[model samples]
Structure formats: structure tokens, C-alpha cells
Target: MQVMKFDMCYICLACFCIYVSGCERSNNRQIAGEVEGERIYLDEVDGMITNSLYEYLFAISETRIIAANELINLKVLKIEAGSRRISVDSLLSMEMRRISMQETKLKYIRDNALQGGVVDERNPFKLHPLDTPAGAEILNNSYQKFLRIRLVDELRVKYRARILLSRPQPPQVDLTNVTSHARGNLKALHSVTIVSDFDCPVCREAYPELSKLFERYSDHVRFEAISLSSSVTPPILFAECAAKQQKFWEVYGYLYGQKGYDFNIDSLIAQFELNREECKSCLESRDQHKIIETDMNRLRQVGIEVTPTVLIDHRVYHGPLTDKAIGRFLDDLFKETPNPGN
Candidate 1:
């Protein structure tokens, strides 16, 4: 929730208006400015900022503000690159190609296996059922991903190549006192803890991937799912009640795989073959609310600010909960140690 100061924002707005006025006066021609004999154009900055804003639905003033900031930053970077005898445009094009290829590969898989006529059963990423609102949701998410990739490509070229920012330090979270509903071996060498909300769509999307990882690496990795909020407390408590009957996974899957958040606990109990009397008693006890509160407090202590934040061995990852990304993270962790079974 950080924001620039009002005066600073006002200055940015003034600069933007001046730049736009310059462009209009020049008959909407490309060149907006020059940096150390190198030409900086309005179109290039527009392209970068426009692509960045594609995924967002902001007000016109807000969009202009963002575009102005991006344009200013890009001009500074271009000047720096010129000083270093480097071509910013060339670097950006190369990075864009790299990002484009990676995105293309992911989309190809999604199209062929998930969205196309034939469903590939072996594909790890689950596709939302067609003819459903969830399907449209997933499609919109994919489009956003493409737009983000474009923004990332431009930013990486500007910052990463020049080492403008240092690598971010991971959050220091103490996991010793945390309790988790877990699968896989407790004594396993590596631990994967997911602090997530059952009500969160992203967390629900990550569920199957984590399940697959647990299944695949049960011997080597301990997998824990800690419920992080009261937002989905009812379903979570229902799952806890099912856990009392040793049917947690079944209930967990049923809840997440359902079309929407409106859950019927009694119906779920019958569907999952849980003992009705015991589950009803457990639900009525209200003890699971305390458990959820404890988890949320623990997350807050560790500066967790998002749903579906993951801690794989001690490294934290936030959002973009794709199977491939998680797999790569796990692979990096695995590479640092001897075989877990050893």
C-alpha cells in the first residue's frame, strides 16, 4: 500500500502533460527527446507502458500517471546505457525474445493439452471445465500472464543487465513453532510448507500441484498445508472435521475441486463418507477457529501479506503459483543437498 507523495505525483503529472503536449505539437511524431545525442522517442515509451497496462483496468488519470513514471524511468535507463556504450533497444529486444519464447512454450502446452479439442490427461495443470465462468476466468488470467511477461522483459533489460537493484533478501520465518496439516514423511530431509487460504482461487489452483509433488517426493519431502485465514474457515473446519475421521485429503480435494465457494458441509460429509455425528460435533466445537487464528498470527509475524505464499525449505515464493515454477524451485533446493533418501 505504499504511494508516492502528492507533490511528487503532481510533478510527474505535470511532466507527463508537457511530454504529451510536445508529442501533439510535433504532429504525433516519434521523437520526444534526446539523451546524450541518442534519440528517445514517444512511441517506444508508449509501447512499453501500454504493454504494461494491458492486464490492468485503471482509470485514465491513473494510467497516465503510471505511463509517465515508466517513460521517465525508461529515458533515464536509455541515457545510462548510452554512457556505457550499450544499446538499450537491442538489449530489450533480446530479453523480449527470451520472455516471448518461454511464454509461447507455456501457451502451446496449455492450448494443446488444456484448451484444445483433445484434453491431454498427462498434463499436470488442470483446466477449468469448459462452458463455465471458471473457464473464462482462466482465459483472462492467461492473457494477463502474457502482458506481464512483456513488462518483465522490458524491465529486465533495463535493470537486470545493468545490475541497478540488488537481489532481494528472502523473509526470515521461524517454522519451528508452526503446526501444519501434513502429508509425506515427517522425517524427510526437505520440507515444503504452503501458507494458503482455501477460499483463494490461486491457492486452489496450486492444490493439485502440491499434491502431485507430495506424491512424487513423499520419501524425500514433507509437505504441509497451513490454513492462513478465516475467509474460508467453514470449509477448512469441515476439512478438519473430516480429518478427525482420517478423510482430510478426500474432503480437501472435494472442496477445492467444487465449482464455487458455496459449500454444504452435511452433503460433503456424506459424499466423502465421513461419520456424520463425529464431524457435526467437531464442527460445533469451534476449536478449528483457534487453530486458524494461530496460523494467521504466525504468518503475520513472518510478514506474509498474500494468500498462497510458499516456503520450500526456507525460501519464500509469492504468487504465480504454476507447477513448472514450483518444480524449478524444488529442483534448485534438491540440488543443494544429497539425495533425501540417503
Candidate 2:
């Protein structure tokens, strides 16, 4: 039986170990090439390993990783023997570039390890899709690989040894206190809030799915719709003012269900006589500006750069809503303990 000796360094790095003829120096000397298993076959001084491959190894080291692919004449750097003493940049141009490449790789891996997976052209740094068996398997494998290489003990401690890249849970909505929304006492548990501009076509597309989600989960979720048009009609203002009069959800339905602009605030403003000055003042206040800014910040923080930005719990969903995305959010949310009094 041929027994395989465990070369700890390469095994730890998950590199294929290779044994080559006439190269057995194991102490503190510099060697460079594609390192398979125990093999140290050298490459030309100018041989380049792309930054994508180098950063994975660099992530394990103490230095910051820098991309060497853009640098001129880059090479792979490796530590030889056990001595930390190595030549400075002026002494070995190729060696310096290699060290730089190693540092680059290490930094890249360390940063992404915190994110639970590496971002590459292929994976695109997104939350791994787990809708299918193949996708689920891939996500699981990536998470496992992330945990294996990451050196941060605290992260490993907090993650329960499992890597997850989803947003944190959102607080539960209070269905019983629905009247409070009309009373102008609005508070969101999260620092960032989302105020949807309902007139947006993309928002129109999202409304139904959002409505369904709100119906199922309104007890803990709080989303507000604010119209951006300067013109007001009776139906529009009536619906909004009635909400303050403890009739928000009902008016919301009436206003949104209407097929046309016949429901604009200007059309219903005189009918409701809802103190136009107060309503207009509320809509135009710097406070409203602050609210929109808060929403924008929340979207940006979570990397939602486009509209139809739906803040479901703590997760930010971009583009128009999808049943699949909503399902995923619900699935993830239920996995946690429901909030008290939700």
C-alpha cells in the first residue's frame, strides 16, 4: 500500500501537493511557482499568478494583500525554510512583487472571509442562492470553505461555525395597534427606514406583493407610502388624512385600489376638508426630507443602488418584488424567535 504523508502546509492551504525530482530544501529559503503538494518546482522570475488565485493564500498571512495582476512583472512569493528573515525589495524585484501579491491575496481573503464567501467574477459577492439542490449545495460548500480559512476567532465564535450572509432579523409589526399609524406616532426599530414613493411605476409593480407580505406580517413590519406629487386631489388627501383619523389601512386600500388619477389629493382635498395647510405642511417639512434621507441611507448601506428598494425586515431587496424573494425572507424570518407582542 502506498501511504501518503501529510504535508501540513499545503494541506492547510488546500493546495495540491506535488513531489518533484531533486528539490528537497525545506528550511527558510525563497521558492516560487505553482505550489502543488510538496513540489517546489520554480517558475521564471516573471511568471505571473493572477490576483484572484493569489489572494486566497494571502488571506492567511499577516500582511495586507495587494493586487499584483496590475503590477508589472509579478510573481508568486513563498517562504522557504523556517527563518522569517527575507531580502528587502531593492534586493529582489521578483521576490518583492511576489510578497506584494501574497499580501494582496491575504487581504482579499480576510476581508471576504468576514462576508462568509469570496467575491469573484463568478459568484458576484451576492448571498448564495439556495433555491435548488445544486445552489444549496454550492452555498453550503462555500460557507464551509469560508469557515475553514478564516482566522478570526470572534467571527467563528459568533457564527456558530456556520457562515451566513443574510441580513439580520427585522422587528415584529403591531397589528393590534394599527390605529396608532393614523395618529402620526410612527417609529421604526431599525436605524434606517424606507419611505416608498408610491407613484413610481416600479413601486406600483411592487405594491401588490408588498401588500400581500404586509398582510401576512404587518404585526412586526412598518412601511410607509408617501406621494411625491405637488398637486392634491380629494381622494388622495382624504385617504391620507383619514388614516390620521384612525382609518389609514382602509383609506390606503381605497386610494391604491382606484385604477386612475381620479384619486389624487387635489380631487379629494376639498371633500375631506382635511386642513390642507396642515397636510401640505406635513408633506413639505424638513422632517419629511429626513425620512427620505434615512431611507436612502438604509438602501445604500445594504448596497441597493436602484429603486423598488424593498426593506423587508433587515434585508434589502432591489428591483420589483418577487414571490420567490418574499418567500425566502419569510423562511429566514420564521427560523428565528418571533418578537414579543408581535
Candidate 3:
């Protein structure tokens, strides 16, 4: 009978109002209309529905809902395990370590291979091309799959674990009007949209990870970067101007990779061999500033408060980014569709 409550401070009032209206319209549904006098059973345990939880559920998008469900499932499972004298925390820690080890191994192999060229004999980390028969064999191995299956089988046998809740489909987001710097196939089925600010340190750190994703999944996922920064406007303006000359990505890389907050635009112009006059004119004109403002407003409307937020298949993830996290998100999205690259 132990229940978890939702924290309302994280959610906005506007979203709550919308949820309330939706609930009023869905009066015929059992758990949709009101939080009181409603319960959701998980393994014969009653999860009391509270108004805060209901508002939180209705306020957030599908990704957040699925994440919340997962948290609820974990809580229920832990309670169930306690009744059976099982150590759920130990089991979870073990499972996490197993997954982490597999990921580390794969990352090491991939990083070495992608570095390319002469093997640095001194560097034990050096790897061969992934296309090589040896590298290909290792990359194609199903050790991770075997480990996961084994873990799942053991857990199910021991705990009689089952997932009764179904994951809802992620909501679709319209990106037609958003100004973005894009890389990868335009028609790719999976779309990753990043709302980042040039002045944000976290965004700078995320830039490389985002680039890595574009490089790895360009054939399957369309990647777009939208600029939004409240700290500094010049860098974003420079990026937009550079986009006009078909050099957004080039300028973007430099801006993100630069060591300091104060960057030399002239050096970048010279380094990229951009038309100095045109770039300067574009910067001074401030026409592209409106585009950044529009992008900012659009993100705000959708309830995003942080920079370096990534929307992959409409599931929002904030950063500091990691390859494993991005990979897992893509894997989940790919699992639901037959043609992942569609």
C-alpha cells in the first residue's frame, strides 16, 4: 500500500491546466478523470493515484511518462523483493556493472579502430579498422546480448518478475520551422534535434558527443542543432551567418571546440576561408538573430528549461551527453519499428 507522490515544482502550471481539461473530457475512462478513488494494481499491490501524480503524468510528454512508469515499476519490484527476502539493490548494482563492462569493451574497440592509420606501438589502446575481418568479427559478436538475456532469465526465475505496464508511443514533434544546422540523411526515420547554446559550457562539451552520434548514425538518423543562448549572442549570430555561406558545421565545430568563451571570429573566418566581407556583413545585419529567438521561444513553449537538450524520436534527454546513453535511446526507438532506417 506504500505509494510514491509526484513533485509539482518541476512542472509548469500551464501544463497542469491542460491536463485538467483533458481529464474533464475523458470522464468515461477509469483512471483518467480523477486521481481520488482510483488505483493501479501492479503485482496485486495497489498504487493509489494522487492528484499531483495525475497532473505530473498529464503534463509531461511520452518519454517522461515512460520514465516515470519505469521508476514506479522499480519501486513496486523493490517492495515485492523485500517481501520475498530478496536484495533488490544488490541485484540492480550487479546488472548495472555487467552492462557497463560490456559498453566499455565495445567503446575501447571502436575508438581504437576509428582513430585509423599507423598503430602506435607504445599505445596499447590502438585498434585496427572495424572493416578488418578480426575487428568485424569482434564488433559483430553477441556477448552483450547473451549477458542481457542471461540476466533477464535469472531475474525472472528468482523474482517471478513481469512487466504488466505497456510503454506508450512517444509524441511526434514538428520541426519544419525550426532553424537548425543539420547533418545526415534528410529522410532518415529517426530524428535527433539538439537545442544548444554556444555560450553554455555543457553545450560545448555535448557538441563532440552530438557530432559523434551524427557520424555513427548519419545513415539512420537525421541530426539537427538549434542554437539558443541567453549568455552570449555573437557566437550564435556568427553560426547563423556562416550557415548562409554553407559553412555552419565548419564554424560550429570551431566554436564548440574552442578553449575559451571569448573566440576570435576573424581567425575562424580565415581558417575556414569564408568571405570576410560577407560574414562581417551578416554578423552586423543581425537578421539571423531572429531565427535564434524563434528557436528559443519554440523550445520554451515545449517546457524546456536547459540548454544542450536532445530530442531523439521525440524523447527529450538533457546533457552532459554520453555515447552509451544516446546508443541506448536509439536502440529503444529502433526496437519498436521494423525498418529502423525508414
Alpha-carbon RMSD, candidate 3: 13.0
After aligning candidate 2 to the native by TM-score, how far in Å is the CA of 32 from where it should be? 26
**Prediction 1 TM-score vs. true:** 0.50
TM-score for each predicted model, relative to the true structure: 0.50, 0.35, 0.56
Q: In lDDT terms, how accurate is model 3? A: 0.63
Model 3, which residues run further than 4 Å from truth? 1-171, 318-320, 338-342
Clashes of 2: 41
Judging by TM-score against the true structure, name the best candidate: 3
In candidate 3, how many Å is residue 175 off? 3.5
How well is each residue in 1-342 modelled by candidate 2, as lDDT tens digits?
111222343254444212211233344433664455554434322122322222333332211112222121122111211133554333244433444454453464465463343233375655543455645566555554443233223223433443133342222222221112321113433211233443556656666776676556555545554333323433434445555545556666555655555645654545555666766665556654454445445444334344454444434433236655565445545555444454
Q: What's each prediction's clash count?
A: 0, 41, 0
Alpha carbon deviation, residue 197, candidate 1 (Å): 1.4
- lDDT (10s digit) by residue, model 1, range 1-342: 134554465466557656755775775578768989999888666644431232221223334445555665576557656776879866555554666666674574475464542222355365566457766556555555564456554655766432221112243467666667778778877777887777888888877777676776777777777767745378777877778788877777777666675587767777888878888888888576676567678776765657777776655654246666567555655666745454
* Residue runs of model 2 more than 4 Å from their true location after superposition: 1-195, 220-255, 270-273, 280-305, 318-320
Query: Which of candidates 1 and 2 reaches a greater lDDT?
Result: 1
